[model samples]
Structure formats: structure tokens, C-alpha cells
Target: MSGGDEQDGPKHEEEGKREQVTVVVLGDLGHSPRMNYHALSLSREGYEVNLVGYTGSKPQIEVLNDEHITLRYMRPPPNLSSLPRLIAFFVKVLWQAFFLFFTLLTGPCNKALLLQNPPGVPAMPVCWLYCFLTRTRFLVDWHNYGYSILALSLRKSHPLVYIYRMIERTFGRLAHGGLCVTKAMKIDLQQNWGITKVTVLYDRPAERFHPLTLEEKHNFLLKLSSQYPCFSSDSPDKTAFTERYADGRLALCEDRPALLVSSTSWTEDEDFSILFHALQDYENVRHQFPDHYPPLIVVVTGKGPLKVHYTSLVADRQWSHVVLLTPWMTAEDYPKLLASADLGVCLHFSSSGLDLPMKVVDMFGSGLPVAAIYYPALPELVKHNENGLIFKTKEELANLLQDWFRGFPQETEIKETYYDFYKNIDEFRKLQWHSCWTCNALPLFSYGKQKHAKE
Candidate 1:
């Protein structure tokens, strides 16, 4: 062969190697923000990413907009409600294993597989087998222990829970590398599961979450008012978020309602009743001290199973001082709404008590002070009296709410502590999602890659 032919052969061989990574989550891609962040960060690092997950709510625009990332959807198996629950669960797992294995088998240039564990019933074993067969690297992103989550509904001593823990512990140790949500989880993995190759990649808000400008907040409120009129004032004229100036410039509405935001899946983990009781106490406080507290527009966003149950309860209430608005919104608008809010509340009780809440991280990123329900691992993220407050009981939360918005827009000596949240959050937001992921997560994913392969 001529010199040109020799050169062409080496180039062709080089091009044949696949340096790409497939990031998998068995849940809704849109709702799984951490995996989505991993995909985006990998893309930014100049690696091709194939994001695999169930098709549900449309993923955020960032994923769709990126050229380097492609979304591969897997349809979840339908549970036959007619069949016994055990038989149906068996059918579902079998289907998931088949689909997941083949999905990875056909993926182009799958140099590594990064999995989100929780629905680890079949995903863990299936992914480990795939990695074993293909000589591909397997990495588990431990959001929480799958068996621990299962134990939430099932008894800890249930036969199935024991089996799940055995399976998770077995394949979990086979992972080439791992990323967990906290140091506590990392230690747990090492001691119990024998998975020592772990990195703590705490959740951070995506760049989309930040404090919105005055004009941006007004515009967002105007758009939101069209759907949820709770955002509009009682008058026919102005929105609850802003008022007009003579020169056509808009300012926040005078005596504007304080916006408090919280989101929930209405699952077994987060007890929404605490928030409900807190609202009741808040109403009594307003009745007792009429003019002292600002009228609160608490917008609880997100669609979930128990939403209707709570909606019915809200309708039965006779709350005058506080208005509760539950609006299901698109992912695109969530951050904007978060950024516009004055305070955020979290009632998430971790099933394992080792993982931190992503909502609190997003709240901090949006520069909103939070009143989070206390948990064992909460202090890792929320520093009491610093960036946010931690409370145990509904009464404590109500008192916190009363103190946070003590004097409306007017500043009070007690509310002066609120400004410190802005400073602390600014320091916190300095380590954005990309930086955090790159620092702790990237190296693990970069493991076992061929240096000779094209990036």
C-alpha cells in the first residue's frame, strides 16, 4: 500500500472506537434532574452522551438543545391491575431487564454506563451483566439505597426487602466506580455494601436556577396570572407581582403578597400534612396579629398522586390570611418561579435519611431562604441560621414562616437575619452544578476509558 493508504487505515481504525457514555435512569427523564445534569456536563466536556430513561414529561430544553447528547427512551411495562400485585411486579421487572439489556447492547460507542439507583430491582443486575459482557465500565449513582426505599412501604423484615438488599449489595460491589449524594451514604456503602470506590457528588442547582431580575419576575408573574388567577390581584387591573409606573416601567405591586414556594411528589416520603398544619397555625397567627404579617401566596408546584386528596382538603378550609395555590407547571417555568419566590419550604423526609433534598439545593441556588423539615442528613446541606432554617414540628415551621416575612417589604431588626441568606447563597451558588459534577463525578466516569480512543 502507498503512504496515503497506510495513513487512511490508521485513521479508520481510530474512528471505529467508541468513546461515548450512556447515562441511564429508570424514572422520568424530566424529573431526574441529577442524571440530566450529568448528561449535560458530559456533553460540555466534549463527550457524546446517550441519556436513557422512561419517556414521560419532556426533558428540560437544555438536553434537547445540546448537539452532543441524544435521549433514548424506554417504555415502562404496563402493570396489569387485574392481576395480583406480585405477579404484576414480576412481569414488570422481567420486561425492564429485557428492554434495558438490549438498549445497552445496541447503544453506539457505549464506553461506560452510569445508572441512577432506586428502581434497582432489575437495573442493577441488568446493568452489571451488560458491563460484564461488553467489557464496558459500570458506575452507580446512589441517590439512595433501593432496598431502603422499598422498606418505606414494605416492612423492613419482608422477604422481598431482604432479597432486594442481597441483590443490590451483590451487584453494587461490582461497579467500576460510584457516586453518592453524601458522605454518610459513602460510608454506608463501604461498611455495609463493600463498595469502596465512591465519590460524594452532592446535588447543586442547574444554571437555570438563579435570582430573576425585577422585570423578569414581573413578566413571569404576568404569564403565570393567565393560568392561575391566584397570582393576580382581586382587582381587574394589575397582577399580584407588579404594578405600572407613569413612564411605562413596571415595579413590584405595592403591598404585594409574599411568595412562598415548595414542590412535592406527594409521595410517602414527604409528609405534606406538616405543611398543612403549618398553614393552619399561620392562619391563627394572622387572626391574632392582623397587620404584622404579610399575606402569603404559597404556591406548591408539581403533579403527583395525592395532589387531589390535598386539593379537596384545601377547598374545605376557611383560610382568609393565607391562599394556597397548587399549580402544575412545565419544567421550564419551575426555576423562574423558584427565583421569584421570597422563601421556600421542604418537607422531604429521606427514606434512608442519608440523601439530601435536591429542592433545597435549587432553592438556595435561586437565592431563596428555606424552612426545611429536619432530618438526620439535612445539616450537610442546610446550615441553620445561615442559609436556611431547620424545623421539626409544624408549630416550629409556622413560627419560622411568621418570623421570615415578619414586616412585609419593610425591613425589621428580626428580618435583618434574612439578608444573610442572600450572602450565604451567593457563596453557595459560586459552586454551580457543572463545577460540582466536574470536581467529584467526572473523574469516576472518565475511568477505564482507552486513552487512544477519540474523545
Candidate 2:
């Protein structure tokens, strides 16, 4: 779906016209939060943003009611019966890239083309060619290295893997500027690939995510139970699961149940098994403390190829305490659910060691302390026992849960610690969002420099 105020020909510097930026992502727009943020932020900042992406269902032509932004979606290709699966995948990618190239080339010349990487193999080269031909500024936002993720399925020594790596590095260098999600990734790109114009842009959650009031929490819980009958209080073990106090106290409060929320993409890179095993361990450990309430565990995930397999595993295990909600939620309900949660768990281990998870950022925005699975790049965001807890093993995760459930003698002190951490995160998020465009992208691209100069 693509329709917007199209220029009759190539747009020139007409007086009082806003600069145009075409933000392209080969992935689904609904799933790509970083690209969504980019398009929204640019549109908010007085730039005309044409967001190009793929939509599985209906195309979303407008987002956030911003007139300056237009979303253009490409429907995925049908399955090919003759060619090998891998070859078929590339064929689809090539077809999509060709369409994207023509779409951008005909729209407006001399505008910035901001592309999201990972699917970079098909997108970067096409974007680079467009930029080269039209004198457009091509910039890449590296969420993760596409080659490293592909290497997870194919051996690094494979010819396809080697070609993917070469394409990424070559096109990445040719781009005018690049933005990465982590400092480690920035360092890697600078030292290994010699991409000097890269900058680190940490992910930030939308402003809607924040701590909910008690009434709001209750309303959200009611809505959740009504939407998903499995979470209703009519369940047999209703009395066993009561809401624990939110002020760092494990004591059962009223009818409200302690909420444990997790958002995952349900991919191979994310080790959900660790979370499942840890939940099992916590179940056994919780029995030891009868006075404590059994928390409600909600694992929110999008439907993927492994969804059925994981759902079957959960059913087979009969984790009565846990609820696995599949598919995506509406924008309004998602943050409401997130903000109402007592704690958030992140199980993403980056396919590339340098990448970070955006789910954690969203959790933090809601003032929810997280228990994140440790990865090489995680420490930069999650400070162990400070803003949040980080664990490398299932045992450690169980122990953390045990501590959370086992009320401390100095409950007030513990609450203070959490409050201090929340304050730190709030301050950090403010600073990050305030300087997001200026510090991260501005000095690298020519248009960014012009914007900065105007400011």
C-alpha cells in the first residue's frame, strides 16, 4: 500500500518546503520498532518521511496521525516450488529490492534514503546504487549485522555467508552514515570494518509507556482477563495467586495478582528454554514459601514459525501458572499491559554478540525492573543489581525470583534501592531522547548538518 502527495517530477528546493526522507526496511513495519521510531521522529521534526516496508496483512498508510509520514508496504512473494528454499529466498529478496529501487528512484531525487539493516544484503546495495545514481544521501541504521544472523543458519565458511558479509561491509562503507544500537557495535564497525561515520543510537520507548496508577492497573488487568479467558479469576487456583505488593514487599495484597511480563519475538536467537526452565525452578522454590503469592507469568510474543512448537511445549509442560499470548497487540493495549506489570523479563541473546534488545528499553520506560539474560552487550544497558538484574544461567534467574518473592526484613530499604534505580533510568531516558537526533545522526550526514546549523 503506497499513496501520498506525489511530486509531479523531482522535487527541488522550493521555498518553505520541508526536506524529504525515505525510510526503508525490508522487514515488517509492525515488528520493526527502531524504524518506526525513526519515521515518527523525523516526521515530528518537520521532515516528510516516506516509510517503505512489507506488511503481511493490510498496509498501514498512516501512523500517529502525522501528515508528513506515509507508509508504503510491499506484499511478500508467494512460495516457489521449483527452486531450492535458499535460492527462492534470494529470488524474493531480489524482486523486492528491484521494486524498492524503482519506487525510491521515481519518487524524489536528492532526498535522504534511511535504510534499516538485516535484510541488508538485498536493501543496502540497491539503496547504495540509488544514492550513487541520484546523488541522494544513503544512511543505514544497523540493528544487528545481517551477515552474522545468516551465519547462525549457514556455516561461516559457506560461500553464501561470505558473499553476504562482503556485501554488507562494502555497501556499509559506501553509505553516507550509519547508526548502531550499541557502543560495542559502533566499536566493532569502526575497528573491524573501518566505518568511521557510525554513531551509537540507543533505542527509546514511546512516551506513552510509564508507571500506571493503581486504578489503571486494575482496569488493565480486567481488560486482559476479559480479552484472554485463561487469565480470568474464575480459574480453579484463583486463591493461590494473589497480587504481591508492588513496593518491594512479597506479601499478598488484595485480589490483584503480581504480574510478570515478557515480550519476545520467539526466534532462535532468543533462548526461551532458559526462561521456561527458570520458571519451573521458581515454581518448586515458591512452594517452599507458602505465605508468598504465586505470580502470574505472561509471555507476550509475536507469531513466528516456532510459535506452534513452543506452544506445544508449554501445553505439554502444563505450566498452569504461565500464559503464553501469541500474535501482536494493539498499540494502546501493549503499553498498558507493560506499565501494569510488576517486573519484565527479557530473554534475547543477540544473534550477533554486538546487538542489544529493544524490549528491555520498553520495559525500562514503564519503570519496570527487568531480569535480562546476560549477553556481551547487555551490561551497557542493564546494570546488575542496580537498574535491573542480569543472569547468565537458569539457576541465577531462579535465585533472583526467589529473592524477589522472599520478602526482605528491610523492605523500605529495598524499595529505596528500586526507586533510585528507576530515577536513574528516567533521567537517562530523558537525556537520550532529548539528544537523539542531534548527537546520533547530525554531524555525519549533509542534511543532518544543515538541520543542526539551522538549530
Candidate 3:
């Protein structure tokens, strides 16, 4: 839990009168998109949600203001290097655990502690202890098993890996229930760890990601250019950049350009090199097909360790149509950018091979067709050639892209395909939400309340 200015104080009398109250714990607020979604969802359900997380560069406290919610910010840990850094990390974890213990201890009664994993080694043990001491319900929301992710960097048989796995399994069984992002994860937990009280809560896009009219898209591009000067086509250095629309056969018309958008964090698990190689292949083969126009490939990404290296790689390649933009867009602009795209390419391969990417959800919500790099759990969301296409290798992805460009080039066909895909996506979204909230979340919280009542 992160420390910050406390908002509304706990209502001792009123809280006791109510069935139950939840204190949602998150470790990495800077990048925990799923935690943010859970906070918002819990708040919307009229539950008193106490969000405890780090409030680093992007302060989320202001946006989360509600009568039923309270925000608590934690100080970000120091980014020191080597042995001293490792020591500092452990010390910070202990310090955070100390503060979080009291926060949960002194808060409202009939309590349920909802915690996100990954930082699980430190947080889960503390939360489990707190729940045990206070007779409170403990639930772990599994985005990816922390130990599996750590195994990506360290040896699977390493002592630390074994320790993390021990912590996960030990405290995980103590949890009343758990929520996972994918069904595969849920099955794994039950089969391997005997943690059967878990539910699959698939990620969903925010309401902002939806279809936009042609005029709306044009205005959005204008606004986007204004907000990020680098994106402006009128800039002298950006003269080669052109805005064109598709004529219906995947060919660019006189004033039309096929927009391809991909958002990434540029991390190791993503394998962006695959996308780059596929793009290279597309560029090499594009000219052979005279009827189609080259797509203006837009890559929207956040700054990361590999960003500079990848940017250099892209620049050295000198692909004529590729544009790499790193400007962080406002919440309002991100969906608009997705909506304006003719297609979306997702490169996220789960570090743990269990976690699913939320980027695809956003793309599907925007009614955009997707060409997602395939992983084990990805097939659960992306149906090959149904809602979207999935590819296993660079060559396969390039071939898929070429096929898409060759197959759909007319406006009427594009509209029909777009709507057909959108309808399927719309239905899937509805079903997912219903299952996540009504089937998964409601029961978990209700179980806590029911247990509290019995006690």
C-alpha cells in the first residue's frame, strides 16, 4: 500500500451497519491497469472501495473521487542498482507492509482485502496474515502468477523462484477466493495448487472505445495533430506523411490511406522484433502489388528501456511508411486513435504465458479488426478470421497482412466486415462483462458478506 493524503475517514458506525466494505490493495499503481479497472468497477457497484497503491508520476487520486471511494498513495521505491538496490527493495517492502497492516487493521469491520498479485511475495503474506488475525476475507486477483513472471528473468529452479512459488501456493490457499484474467490461469490454479475458489474475469475496454463517424474521425485527427506537434502532417519534416482512405479492396484511393495502429510497452515479452520483421517483409512485397497503396503504419507506445534501441532499429531500417510516436495521449484521445484505425496489430506475448493483454480488448471495442500475435491464452479472446486473425510467426503475420490487404479493398465490403466483426465483439463484450461482474465479482464479495454475517 502507498501512502498519501487520506480522503474520507472510515465510518465506524455506518460501516458496521452495512454488510461489508472492501479495501483494494495494489502494489504497482503506475502500470496496474487491471487494478484500476477493478477499483472503478467496485466503486460503481456502490461498494465502499479504499484504493491503496503507489501514486507515482501519474496521480490517480483526483479522478477516483467518489462518495464510496477513498484514495491512499504509497511512495515509490528507489531505483538503485546492484546489491544495495536489492537490499533497499526488501526494506521498502517491509516498510510498506508495516503501514498497510495498520491501515487494514484500523479500517472498517466486516472487511474484505482484495489484493492484486505480482509483488505477491511481499504483499500476499502480509495480507493473508492480516486477514487471519482480523478474521477478514482475503481474495487474490491474479493477473499473472508472480513466480512464473520472475522465472522469465531467473532460472525456474532458482531458490528465489522456489520461494515465490512457496509464498504463492501457501498464501493462495489461505485466500477465500481468487479472480484471474484468463480461464487457463484459473484451471492451472485449481489443478496445480488446489485453489478451486477462483473465477475468470476477462478484461474489458472502457466505454470510450467505440465506433466513430467519418467526420468525427477527421476532427479527431486534427485535434490529435494539434495536441502532438510531431503528429501534424503540415510540419515541414513530416511532409511525406499523408492521410488517405481505403477505397474498399484494401487499396488506397486518391485521398484515402489505410491506417494501421499498434500500441506497445516495448518490453521483452512482447517480441516487437517479430512485428518489425513482418513490416519489413510487407514493405519488400508491397511494391509487387501495384493496385494497393502502402499503409501509414502508426506505432503508439510508452517510453521503456528498449524504446531507444527499438527506435534506433526502426530509424536505421528507414521504412518509408512507418511512424513511431511516443507521446502519451489523454484517456479521451487514446480510444479515438484506435477508432480511426482500419486495423490493429497486437504484439503482446505474456511473460508468464498465462496473462492476456488488454490492448486487444481496446482494439475490439473500437470495432477495429485485429492481427494479434498468437500465444496459448490468446485464442480464448481472438478467434482466427472470426473477430480477428491470429498468427504464430513473422512470416505468418506478414502473409496475413498481405491477405487482408488483397481481400478487402472496397468501401461496402469494409463496412460490412467491420460491422460484422463489431457485432460479434459487442456480443462477446456483453457476455464477458456479465460473467465478470454478475457471476464472478458479485459472488466473491457476497461470500465475504455472508461469512461476516455468519460470524
Which candidate tops TM-score?
1
Model 2 residue 41 distance off true place after TM-score fit, in angstroms? 2.4
Q: Residues 1-455, candidate 3, lDDT per residue (tens digit)?
A: 23322333333334553334554554656466666666655554445676777765442442355545566665555554545745765777777777777666666664577888876867898889888888888999888888877877777998878988999999999899889999899988999998999988888776677878765675676676666543466533221233434432221234344567888877787778887787777777665664564454564656567777877887888876455566676666778888877788998888767878888988888888799988899988898867988899988988877776653345325655556666787776664443366567767877745678899
Q: lDDT of each structure?
A: 0.84, 0.73, 0.70
lDDT of 1 by residue, 1-455 (tens): 01121221322135554258899998889889999889878876656789999998877777888766788988788858998978887898899999988888888857789999987989999999988988888999999888888888888999889999998899888899889999999999999789999999989888888899888887788888888777877644368878756677777765777889999988768888889988888888878887888777889987778888987887799688889988776777889989999889998899888999999998888888889998888999999999999999988987888887777766543466777877999999998787788788877766544343545
Which tens-of-lDDT digit does each residue in 132-191 have in candidate 2?
Answer: 988888899999988888888888788888898899999999988889989999999999
Using TM-score, rank the candidates from best to worst: 1, 2, 3
**Better lDDT candidate (1, 2):** 1
Q: Model 1, clash count?
A: 0
* Ranked candidates, highest lDDT first: 1, 2, 3
| Candidate 1: residue 210 lDDT (0-100) | 88
Query: Would you give me the overall lDDT of model 3?
Result: 0.70
Single out the weakest 10-residue window by summed lDDT for candidate 1: 1-10
| Backbone clash count, each prediction separately | 0, 1, 16
